[model samples]
Target chain A: MKKKLIVKKNFLMSLFAVILGLIAGAILMFVTGSNPIEGFYYLFRGGLMNIERIGNSLATATPLIFAGLSVAFAFKTGLFNIGGAGQMLIGGLCATAVGLTFDWPKPILLTVIIIAAMIGGALWGALPGLLKARFNVHEVVATIMMNWIAYWTVFYLVPLYLKGPFLETESQRIPMAASLKVSWLTSLFSGSYINLGIFLAIIFVAITAFILERTTLGYELKAVGYNRDAAEAAGIGVNRNIVLSMAVAGALAGLGGATFYVGFASNMQIGVLPSQGFDGIAVALLGANSPWGVFAAALFFGLLHTGKGFMNAMTAIPPEIADTIIATIIYFAATSVLIERNWDKLNKFRLALRLRKSKQESLEDDSGGEQ
Target chain B: MVDLIYQLFPYAIAFTVPLLITSLGGLYSERSGVINIGLEGLMLMGMFVGALIISRTESIYPGTAIWIGLLAAMLFGAVFALLHAFACVTLNANQVISGIAINMIAAAVTVYLARLISGSGNIQIIRGLSRQTIPILSDIPILGRLLFTQTYATTWFVLLILVVATFLLYKTRFGLRLRACGEHPHAADSAGVNVYRMRYMAVIISGACAGLGGATFIVTISGEFNGTAAGLGFLALAALIFGQWKPWGILGAAFFFGFASTVANVSQVVPMLAQIPGIYLKTFPYVVTLAALVLSSKYSLAPKAIGEPYDKGKR
Candidate 1:
């Protein structure tokens, strides 16, 4: 019962953060000489106006879901994996390489591509984990360094090995057989960019939920996160769990890369770290680090992302405003500690008011009886 | 080799100055018990404001506009950092998340405004600081040629700030107090130091210095604000760690990174370096930083109470 209440409170906090974010966005719109209500109306309308748009929103959210899951998973171990971008890059590169090199049947090729991405991402994630566990190196710094290394690696490797026939900047387009899109799905969504990635995302979300809630590994990781010294004293191999958690986190992000590169995007672009990596942080924070919460948050963010361009087309507000709103939401989410404090204060104030009102009413009743 | 060294010297210094200053900014915040990963965002704010102000006023005030722009960037950057300060110091929020939020907001808002003003997400200034050789210093020997000749005024300015910062941080009572706040905030508070105020000031100073660093990049190297600092801010963070949070150490570390990056950028054209793959050169500094972290992990000189929120009631 208490756990359920805490979950509800977290949900409310997230909702409050979202509302604050929207208000901040409205203020920005107002400052920029646009009608806030009108801007938001069009933003939501643009996201939900058609089945095609909704599908696009889900497609856009596919990578975000995985990224969010990855971050959330690592956070459970008290590890900050800021190297999501690098991990994604590596994952995407591996998936792209497998897709381009092989001409196997679709199922076999896709499975190989996904596995390759997972392995690549896992290595990238595990390196920082190992460094942190063994050398006491801060994961944040290690991950960031890893990010730049991955960046330069992709910058060099893609152009040299995976370059398309004419373009020097991007990898060769994946063959149709390896793509996650299918004819039936496309037709169902009225030719939207939705693909197998969304279904993959949902499956992973459920799996992540199961692993985190029902598995011993999840308990160990959480135990370490709560108190490293205590967990160590309790015989948990804190170092091993840290490494394993990071590897798992990296695998999740790697799957995201596969879904992104092969499932959503057709080609791997060089010199660009996918922004979804950073957006994953926002999604995790707003989702309260819960798998289902992450799913819901990613979908909302996806809607904002998909709707932004349409809003820009229809209104004076720029597409960047959507990003602004999302960023503001993240900022509020980070500062939710203040809101939690204030919430308690408000509850106390209300109780005090009720108590004072009851005392006055009893005093009045006594005075009337004496009269 | 001599020719190549001479050619690369100025470019290397140009890159190092901004990084050095920014790392120093991070030094202040971290030394005051706050982890400020928002240096990147603060720097972006600096770049954007610098570009926006300079682009607007350069036509009318060609000689002085850049200075004004830089000043505005510092002001805006300091102002923007207040958000981070409020979140981390006042509200006791997660510093890392707050810093990330700062970065995201800076990136999005700057581009949003830039697109509004320029119709593209980039702002360019008409003129940037020119390299000027010091009159007396330039005639001195090889040292003069490499260090004093054809240098940016901002480079000298930043170097001066570095010296002052070193002195202020080491020689002053205020510095000691600030250091105390970071190392042991409860003790500092018991000793009559206002931990929160010191942290707020430190974070604000970090913002201002990081802002100056960003503007320095615009005036000296980039010559435009393109909505990103190209991870220079993160590199500055690495330098801060690499330097072990010391001012002079930061200078050396920043220069090392600067030199490495300059070599990577020019390696293709330099015959001596052409034999090596560019990837190695490009990733050298980051790899080196990771190695440094490993080597130094046994005896980390990090502030004792860094990243912890001060709660007077707890202790």
Candidate 2:
């Protein structure tokens, strides 16, 4: 690959956002009367210093990766897939239900559960897409309502059918046969919770990249996103593409649900909508809505999350404030488009200044030659 | 049946007042061509600030502190919402994304600040608004028994706001200008309206009202702030949409959701609703909202340029 000092446009912009986010986080630490350098040092050390921490970071990043892709993919097709949490919930619920109920062989059951999760998530996702496409209803409201629906569904169903031995809040743990952890993988990682989900996440990353960059479906979807009326006038079925994009987005988040409830940790808990779903929005924005960009952004966010507890333990800053730092980072990341726009304007101003200097220099040369 | 009706109605009104106020707040922002999904965060800001004020002043003013809390909540809510306003309105950020950031930040910041102030994450409001009977209205038979008896002073205050909000939205030149900005901002500009200023003012006002709603929530329901409005902001947004972006329509929607929420909260307390599962009751409003969005949205008429950032150069 040819190397450039600034790299690509979206990646460069995202890098700027990341740097800005870190500086903002540091400022927050400073404001709270903590040493920013010391805080950041331990934060990185917590997520990367040990093999277990590395494995744990990758494990934590797994769901975020899928959720980011879900949001990013739909974004490419002009759909804001804010329902990642609901899709993840429904997907996790279906996967857990399958994992606990089935007695099938390992590969078969895992495959079945994964497929069920994708389907369940797809249904939840496509509903809002369909409404937006057909009726012009806003996706944000529909998806938010769907989140509550999924929340209540899991809250209701877990206790009624999947209750564990002691806890009324969580579903029964998955049996070893249906679990995502292979003995070799666990040993290779030295007893970490990192499972098959990480590999699957990498594979899906490549698959999404191919689907987005190399397919006619991707072209059609992008055409719709760029201008729906123009796409429709050009003979593209904008409505179909919208729903299809959301389904694909939902499928990715569904896989993440499998990663979370079955792979990283077993059993679904009631009452809490997965914060990863909202975090996906930040990830997607920071990544500039690209699949590979989302992968990197998710890993970065994973480091922040994994390192946070350690950052808290070593400093006067409490965990709640640490969480506030993460949120502040997200707040800045979301406004990165502002930074990008300003950067573009600044570039234009520089180009104009350079042209004016060149014009003045040529005029001076002409005058000197005449003299 | 009358007794059951009597019991649920007062509870429903208590619930309705906040939802109504919040939805009205949302209406101002949405009507000015900005989507204020920050209502949730704004509400949380109100709850946090209001509860903080009430907690800190519990000893100083003891009896009148809750009213002071209400004022502090509105001011603080508007202040925090200024971040969102600056992002979406001035910087031309994606309104939904900005709103989501505001919501996430509000939850975290409130908890963090509460922890810093009280040395714990939880901020408790020792005193809250007590239910009061309107002396003359309480003796007026059906109306008094149904609407005036055993209600918080907040119910009347919110009602007064609703009437004022409706009058201002329909009868004032400012409302017309705000509505014009939402529908056709370029046209409004050509008509010599300051679209940007109107939107900013509407959003700030929206934040203030939502904060007041949050104050009412803690005052009427929780009696304490633990860093969430429990999705009441989203429910307010839902009411804004369900009411078809009109004041009367939003009131009806808020009333419906309020009753549904009351049912969910009071299911165990009420003998008839106790037999139903808690999950179903909790899920009812969401399901109904989704169905309503699906079935009625085709006929819905939103402000023409609602979610887009206005560019002076663009046609």
Candidate 3:
């Protein structure tokens, strides 16, 4: 019971730290003659003013949700998936290929492209996962290297592979058949080109949460993350969990890639590949690696990004400041030790007070008995 | 045949020097078990600051002194990385996430700070190091022209650092302690070695080395900083891995990468290769780096506790 209270205190301290960092940043801005209140007002109004703006936000949020989920999922099985960017890239390119090359019924074509993207992403993700599981290789090194490989591989291969009308230095336009339509929910988004992908993203998060929280597989995975030797002793297949978690994580990021092709851009070039995968890491960290937390974090990042255009339209403040804010939050949030140490102090104070009260009660009882 | 080898030699040596120096810098941090993902950021900051100082001073000797100015940038990079270390080391945060955060923050901060200073993202018109030819070897015909004809002060400095770093990591008592802290911090702590201090030292060394590499780039090649350390951090990272996290091994690997890079750029300029129809040849260096990374995947090993933070009580 005391332990639970300590955990709560640590959390509160970390929260306060983030608040302090924000205040410091705001003070800096104020001293520089940039009104903090006005800057934030511009930020909010520009980000969530109306249905169109909100739709733009969902469009931004969809990929991040997948990316955050990817990182969070991998975190559960004791692996770090730095290759999310690469996996997403592979997924993007694969989806683009399927979108351009295949001819099918509209719904079927869209499904095929999404599946292809997932497979591509999964394959990319599996390589590093397998290497680590089998060879005891460091995933951080492998995944980071893989990111560059994906970057240059796409750089070299995309031009050769892409075909059709949209195929210049940029990618080909995705077929209408391969596009995910949001015709049903146009009222919420006001036809801003944001589709049902936001719902899909939410559903994906739910699925991941459910799998991690309820299933035997989830229990086994969590066990491994906590302690590999203990998990192995408990008869859990540690290697399998590591590989499976990475594969599923990659698929989530792949879906993020599909969302871009089918729901938003309909065309992607090399540089245009969104930093969603990288941003997802920040999102997952900010959310403390919980799936639901990741969903909320994704929304926050989405809001920040969508508001960029709005912020630029309204104020001289660079939209990149929002990213700086996010980085600061992560920095403050990551320093949980300081928080834990403070909480420990608070717990010790409470314990001492409790002990003194008990002693006084005993003394009172002794006096009454003597009388 | 003679002409081809002669043309290749200068380009290879020139390019190899930077990669060797930078990757060797990467070795210090990684060997001590802090994955210095901020190497690229430090290099970028170093390049920018070093360029500005050298340009304002207008003397290569003072330009050489601009490396001291890079200590501020290195400290900046270290503090930036302290964010990562705090996350990964203190909070047991995921290493890759912390790293990516550092990369993002570094990129944004460097650009933002650069804009504040120069009114532009790109800093130009910086004074650079003039390549000095060896006094006695200038007349030694082909070999002299290839090996000793012209290079930055950093080229020789890197060679010397490599020898010293190689010794420091392997021969020195400090090296043994640093390696012990990385591999088994609890043991190191029990032995009264300051584990945290060692890790911080490793990371700071990485920042400084990365700074030197960045400083060298501005002073030698670019004469201006356009964030020319563009993705070179990853290349240095690749070299580190390809070298299997060993100092001498990484130097050789970096040299290979350097050779490939120079060949790619120079090959494009060659009249014969220029006649080719595709851009594939231009992308050869990145392709090689990719291949090197993938092929070395099986062999590269990290310290036992490379990314894990030391928690004495938990132990």
Ranking by DockQ: 1, 2, 3
Tell me the TM-score of each prediction against the true structure. Answer: 0.96, 0.95, 0.87
lDDT, candidate 2, B25-83, per-residue tens: 89999998888888999999999988888888879998888889999988887778788
- State candidate 3's DockQ: 0.35
Per-residue lDDT for B58-162 in model 1, tens only? Answer: 999989998999899889989999999999999999898889899989999999888888887889988999889999988889999999998999898889999
Q: Which ten residues in a row have the lowest lDDT in candidate 3 chain B?
A: B277-286
Report the CAPRI category for model 3: acceptable
Predicted structure with the largest DockQ when compared to the true one: 1
In order, the interface RMSDs are 0.9, 1.6, 3.7
Please identify model 1 stretches exceeding 4 Å from their true place.
A347-371
Q: What is candidate 1's lDDT per residue for A110-172, written digit by digit as tens?
A: 888889999999999999999999999989889889988998999889888989999988999
Candidates by lDDT, descending order: 1, 2, 3
Q: Taking the candidates in order, what DockQ does each have?
A: 0.80, 0.65, 0.35
Candidate 2 residue pairs in clash (backbone atoms < 3 Å): none
lDDT of each: 0.91, 0.85, 0.73
lDDT, candidate 3, at B180: 88
Better of 2 and 3 by TM-score: 2
Reference-based TM-score, model 1: 0.96
Question: What digit string (tens of lDDT, one per residue) describes model 2 on residues A1-371?
Answer: 33352346567777776676677667767887788899888888878888778888898899999999999999998888888998999999999999999999999999999899999999989888888888877888888888888988898889999999999999899998777878888887788778899999999999999988899999999999999999999999999999999888888998899899999888889878898898888888877787888899899888877887787777766555445655666677667767778878887899999999999999999999999
